[model samples]
Target chain A: MTTANPQTNETVETIHEETVETNHDDHGHHEQPPKGIMRWILTTNHKDIGTLYLWFSLTMFFIGGAMAMVIRAELFEPGLQLVEPHFFNQMTTVHGLIMVFGAVMPAFTGLANWLVPMMIGAPDMALPRMNNWSFWILPFAFLILLSSLFMEGGGPDFGWTFYAPLSTKYSGDSTALFVFAIHIMGISSIMGAINVIVTIFNLRAPGMTWMKMPLFVWTWLVTAFLLIAVMPVLAGAVTMVLTDKFFGTSFFDAAGGGDPVMFQHIFWFFGHPEVYIMILPAFGIVSAIIPAFSRKKLFGYSSMVYAVASIAILSFVVWAHHMFTTGMPKVALLFFMYCTMLIAVPTGVKVFNWVATMWKGSLSFEPPMLFAVAFVVLFTIGGFSGLMLAMTPADFQYHDTYFVVAHFHYVLVTGAIFSIMAAAYYWLPKWTGHMYSMTLAKWHFWCSVISVNVLFFPMHFLGLAGMPRRIPDYNIQFANVNEIVSIGGFAFGLSQLLFLALVIKCCRGGEKAPAKPWDGAEGLEWEIPSPAPYHSFTTPPEVK
Target chain B: MTASTQSNKKLITYLVLGCLGMFGFGFALVPLYDIMCDTLGINGKTATTAQAYDQQVINKSRTIRIEFMAHIQPGMKWDFGPTTNVLEVHPGELVKTAFVAKNNASKRMIAQAIPSISPGLGAKYFHKTECFCFQQQPVDGQSPADFPLVFFVDPQLPKDIHTLTLSYTLYDITEKTLGEALTGPQAQGVTP
Candidate 1:
């Protein structure tokens, strides 16, 4: 690798000498990355780690998507044809775990790793070594999680929420492994988040004041704070689950003065903010993309920052909305209900800002722009369903049904996951110094956009018609829609392979990209050369 | 050390402290949940304090049917049920009921019963004056134990709720109690 890249060696030596002359600091001892796989194993470079995280997330997305395929195949005809009920439960559970932790969260972290420093004109992450450790721990964490499936009793069959009595009193022998895996994932997220926070705060270029920083950086700052605050709470929750399962603790046992409902309270306390952690970065990505495609400055930039912070704060009190059917007192129900509805305000502000940014400008539908536009419309549909679910009395009818499943998949799959796809398309040129095949990317987008709706749209009707979620089979009344859904699911699964091929093609070779790939783009990242240098901003640039 | 490095260290310290503080807050929710439940009178959590039953005035104009339900948690080796499944009583009139529990295991076991009332709005109205669910019951091997519950429906119970289901789920607490006993020096007299 060193022989292949003499330019990188010269750049590193120049940075080292410059660092020595400017300040006697520890960073002056920079070394060349080793040849072969050792470069990845022992690398502390942010771009390398970001690549690792992205690849890991894509691999997990396929794994989780394959599990979704199994579910659709089983539900294809609504009979017990593909797998046993026990195995079906495991598929649903592990699929949720992998997608949320292994795919979406890591993908955002990957984007932050790559973009935050470049956007702020920093040398690297605040703690580059910790960044490597954070990325490395994730593979092992997911390995432990996936390995549990082949265990004697099979992996955790409880839903991803893993409510007690089911997870504690009646879970299989692999609950310990599941708990430990979750703990490690939490550690990884917390460390990654801490690095993002510190880098953004301490490493910004001279003139990149708080307001001048890119919206992505600002949103990630809030997101990192949320992660640092809540990931530890998740650690606490899974620890209690481990003890309740193996040790003689009764934290969730009713007979020993413990209430199972208390478990939901703790989990959702960590869980609700966690949902925002997955989405706020999407907001940042979409905010970045909408303007680039529309040739406009982001509408209401300061308000966007305030809206994200408010949403983060409001996330804490609205968790009980998930438990409206648990029979909380009328007053408590009203309080949570109102608080959940109050979240719509800031969210509305964000949606309006995106629309305002795109209103009547010279809009073009590149693959990234297409995904962002789809996100605005489809995510609003998800938001409307969420609003309906927030009403206490209405939730009594919708709880634990496919309606609930439809609501989340809309936000998660279409909202967060689509934003990730858009970010990849938008940044591929900058990272690879080549433009990806636009034709294949558009095919990937259109196939995904249509089939994904065909897959999840019927779930709303199924839920409204009283089909409960997490079940292996349903009554024959729901058979036809399930068939359509399964077909759509398979098509959607196949479309992602095109994305994989596009990425590989871009990385290998394509049309050489200019320094500024997008005509309307504006950022410090755009100011830098394509395939951003081995060490960025060794001498920080002035933003203004 | 440079000022930037010092400030970075301070920020990291505060963030690490915040993470620890949030972890503690998660555990704090345990007590906070109990306090919330007690104050809201939701989730069928009955009051621990015995109530004074008002026998002076009985609302004979209305009759409410009360149903009893019993469940055994998995891994609990005990046979338990309510002596009476259903009873009709006038509002404000105290009623008494009994449940029989027999240890099916070869070894002595301690069990605790958790009570829940359905149509959860009826929880505050259905006051328990004396209930076996308030304490743990330890039964020797193959012995049967009868525990009684004394409660009354307050006349103020909503007129719409004419029927209520009171269910008790029994769980084995032997291991936990044994651990506590061992630490308290009471295990010397007992054989495992």
Candidate 2:
């Protein structure tokens, strides 16, 4: 292995020498990253930015999880036991906002940052300095949102959607801060997406054709497009909310010739595609991991690519499915319902492809595989419920109910968050140069898989029983189920600490990992040395 | 610039333009929604102009229940409601009703009432010859203003619908009008 390492290093050095001779005028000088805190602050290295994003997302995950804890604790019984109703509303709102924007989206971007350049055999992300700025913006944006909780009227209480009239006229003074924070977050996302798109387009190694790119790369390409298209729409929505509140312009005010439902229209236009943005990258990560563990090449590579692109395209027309209960005309409702259900086709194609990949192959259940398999099962459950929600008449009953909550958490927590966990476990050895404790990882998985169901499954029953979501208190009948859900929530929350331990232990020191930890894995990323160097592929590799 | 740098510039320009285009589209949804609602006759949005329906055929066979509802938007300090909640009127029969809107604010304000009809399919059939919702109503400080609506349910009204809700949501448009006034040339004479 040592001899093999030196041989590869010699070839890399020769390639670098040749590239330097050819392109001396373009690259200027390559400098080592500065020391200590400033290294993190001033660094434009993709790895450094990727590390920052991962740590930032983990911290936010905990913060959002803590808010979820409060929500569950309050709902443990019939009456408001832990917090005031208004504060409970803020908890639900901020928890959702943080988990979606702060945790899941950034986690995916972090994964993109770490993997995209290496997978494509590029030196680093295109536009690295802008990458730094994009990551740095998130912490401050979230700080503004979190600090709004202490304000006089309290933080955003109208749920994460922040439907207008409630958000504009009746909201606290801190709403301005919420608007600006969201604006900056949107700016950060757009910049990050542009950076990804540019890198994928401009920085691919020689002989790496579009079809030859890995599934992870293909998915990020589509996700970047979705982000660039929709983040601006979110910015516009917030700007309208800002003007409606401060200025006399009545965009959502009916007397001013504006309709409140129009706010939902604009928001979900951005918001629907935004949901796909969070999940498509998860598909990419799972796609990578499933093939690695199953000991097979992916079942239908080009079909998977087409499936993702189709889903992204279909996302735009399905926004109004979120507004079925908002009193849409029958024709509009029917149009939205059919468009939303059409998403199931491409989504089903992805699931079938994954299942087909594992069929008749020697499959191993490593920690990553466990999480990926779970993601497939649970995310499909979420998708099935989503199909149910797409039915216009049925959605009239399910809208704003815990059934909706269960549907999303099944997708997001088990779907997006679980995939992030899978990606982390899948790549931790490569990132840390050491293997994580598998026994502990298995425990974390079992506990999480069991507890997550406990947490979200009963929500379907509660919703079906006519318990509304975003409420602080419920009647006595819901008490028994709420307790079970709370226990699951707490258990799920605690199990993450085990994951934290595993990551920390691995990072500190553990059994050494090889350059390619997984024998079945195939990628440019696996070809590099473990704990990838500060600079990788200074000269792009020949893909063939 | 080198070829790579030139392509980078082109890609960046495309992305930036795409972002701006979508941003503009978000704002454009406001007008697009209005146009869509106007065309589809959905979202309870009533036509602004009075429709010239065929008044010659009076089919007195069916009685349709019309429910009147009023909403006072926040920031508009007013007491507004229909004097009569429900009216039983035969199809093709003209009916008249009054809505009392009182501006309880300390200062006089200009208010606009936008009307919407429920069972949105019924919007085309419901014709208004005269209605307060046709124009903005300016109320003096702390005074009540009575506005009348005159309309007839179309003789060709669909059979499946039993009741239709007609709602008017009132908004304070004083600042908006005043802001426009300040921008216009008329503000120069008033300032002196």
Best by DockQ: 2
For candidate 2, write residues A1-44 as lDDT tens digits.
Answer: 23336545554455455434433443435544556897788767
Model 1: lDDT of residue A240: 90
Tens digits of per-residue lDDT, candidate 1, A279-386, equal: 999999999999999999999999999999999999989998988887776878999999999999999999999999999888999999999999999999999999
Worst 10 residues of 2 chain B by lDDT: B183-192
Model 1 bad stretches (over 4 Å): A1-32, B49-66, B74-80, B85-93, B101-110, B119-126, B138-145, B153-165, B174-192
Error of 1 at A93 (Å): 0.9
Count of backbone collisions in candidate 2: 0
Residue A94 lDDT in model 1?
98
The model with the greatest TM-score is 2
Docking class of 2: medium
